[model samples]
Target: IKTAVEKIDIDVPNWTFVAARLFLFDLYHRVGKSTHGIKGEPYCHLKEYLKYGKEAGRLIPNLGEGYDLDDLNDYIDSDRDLLFNYLGIKTLYDRYLIKNKEGNPIELPQHMFMAIAMFLAQNEENKQQRAKEFYDVVSKFEVMLATPTLSNARTNRHQLSSCYIGSSPDNIEGIFDGYKEMALLSKYGGGIGWDWNQIRALGGMIDDHKSAAGGTVPFLKITNDIAIAVDQLGTRKVAIA
Candidate 1:
């Protein structure tokens, strides 16, 4: 694959494009053709993928409640597949593509772009139009959304923001409060960044010298524990103090 990829030059600019298509073919093979009730269709079908995926609990519940799933079919840019490099296509397929019950990729790259576009534009006044506009930008990779948006949008558990930054106050009560906040955010797949500056240094006095303090290290242990406990959706464990 590397050798083939390296051969891509001005003379053969589409080498990576052909490779990505082949890669997508392999991805389709790994999963079943579950487009709604039309199983094993031998081809990609966006609406069917959504209907079946939602029914199977692998997708966001009632994602297409009021929207016309068929409209999305028109917005998909089939040529966008040509834009992906070998690495880009592989990364997306490995990490982002929606899978079926059999663990096969049920949606194509274009379907994913449309799903995210519709999801983000769901609340807009002109949702259908907005979705198309959103799809245009994203499919072309002109503008990038945040990590969670890229990862969770248009999915069963749509935690679409990336990071949460809140300070854990100096006191124990405040620290625990921070823990609760972190837990909630982590549960919804957020990376946490807590302010530890408010807390005292190592071996510092605790509670106005009521007794010797374990300082930030003990508290940090708690933070570390939270990071491990709230491991974000098997994707990553995240926290930064």
Candidate 2:
């Protein structure tokens, strides 16, 4: 794969593209004429794959009965497929490509890349131009979106970003309220930001002792601990943005 990537002189820097391409090449070699429901006669096997994808919350759209295999298979980009290198295709198939129940890849490597680009594009009017830019960035690995964002964006779920922000007030009740909000947001694997300025300083309030109140830090610590306890998606660290 390294040797193959070194051979191609495309205007890109990253090895991810090369790897993805290689993965696709291998897949094609292994199963060139494998009849997938979305690509051939609407086989039960392919339908099962598509069903599994939907059940797993994958962004792949289900092609109903009317959208036969011929229609789905017709949506091909042979030209784009040619652009993939050995490594680029392999990496895509291994890590990024969507697969069926039997572990056969449903979407091609180039198609996956195209889908990502489409999802990241600016808007309808400039979609083509912006999609090109997005493709370039992703193919070159200049910038990669978060896993969830990449996985779910531009589809029905359309929650494109990986993070969110919130603010808490100064008073005790307000502070707890803010924590509650943060907790809820964190449930969705979202990051949160809170301002502790409104919170009063410790030891200084309650009437007087205006000299030193220690301020906001304790509440901040408590929030941090709660975040730690709750955690983010069991994988990503809970973070304050």
Candidate 3:
């Protein structure tokens, strides 16, 4: 992988694909050994994979139940794996692919895409067909899902919204409540856009007393701490602005 990456330059940029393929080979070998005790074919036995994920508490309970797993498995084009560059595949492998308790990846890129499609189409009237259509666009890279949606859609957490905007009122209860809300949103991989304009500035009056307010900076510090503390289940730090 390192050698393939090093070989990538302006002249031979296709080396990125080489690196990705190498990385994918390693991923396939690892998952195959861990799950099936052999070097298994890619995109094979996806139903078993979903069952394993549910049993391991890595995926949503209704993931495979809502769809025909065999049909969905057939929709997966293992060739789509070739479409990803090294950086893209690496990012998905590191952050998005469902992993076990020991942090080994269990799902491939197509599996992740199919899972997201199945999840998003779960509420549609013709869900099975809708899921196939969703899978077509997503796996073919015709549409891109937002970061939170891509990361959280098929997982047990399932909070797919990308950003949360909230207003923080001036009072103690309101301010604390806003912090709690931020923590909860951040825990599920949502970026935060908080309106602290309502908060009092430095040296502002509190409870009709003169100059009792520590103001927005201190609260901002606490907010920063919360972002660091609840970091999207350790995938990445919460983005707060």
Question: Each candidate: how many clashes?
Answer: 5, 25, 0
List the candidate numbers ranked by TM-score, top first: 3, 1, 2
lDDT of 3 at 71: 80
Q: Of the candidates shown, which would achieve the greatest TM-score relative to the real structure?
A: 3
Q: Clashing residue pairs in candidate 3, if any? A: none
User: How well is each residue in 1-241 modelled by candidate 1, as lDDT tens digits?
Assistant: 6666777788888888777767766655554534433344333566676776687677787566667667777657677877888878888876677776666676677778888888888899988888889989999999877767877898767788887789977788998988888887887778777778888766677666754766678877887888888876666567555
TM-score of each: 0.81, 0.51, 0.95
> Candidate 2's residue-wise lDDT over 1-241, tens digit each?
6665675565555554565556555565544344233343222233453454566445446323333333333343444654555654554456556654566655554445545665565354666555666666665557766755554553344545567766777566887888888876665556777766666666666555564566777777888877888764353567775
Model 2 residue 64 CA deviation in Å: 14
| Model 3 Cα lDDT, one tens digit per residue, 1-71 | 99999999999999999999999999888777656634457555778788777877888888866678788
Supply the global lDDT for candidate 2. 0.56
Please state the error at residue 83 of candidate 1 in Å.
1.5
TM-score of 3: 0.95
Ranking by lDDT: 3, 1, 2
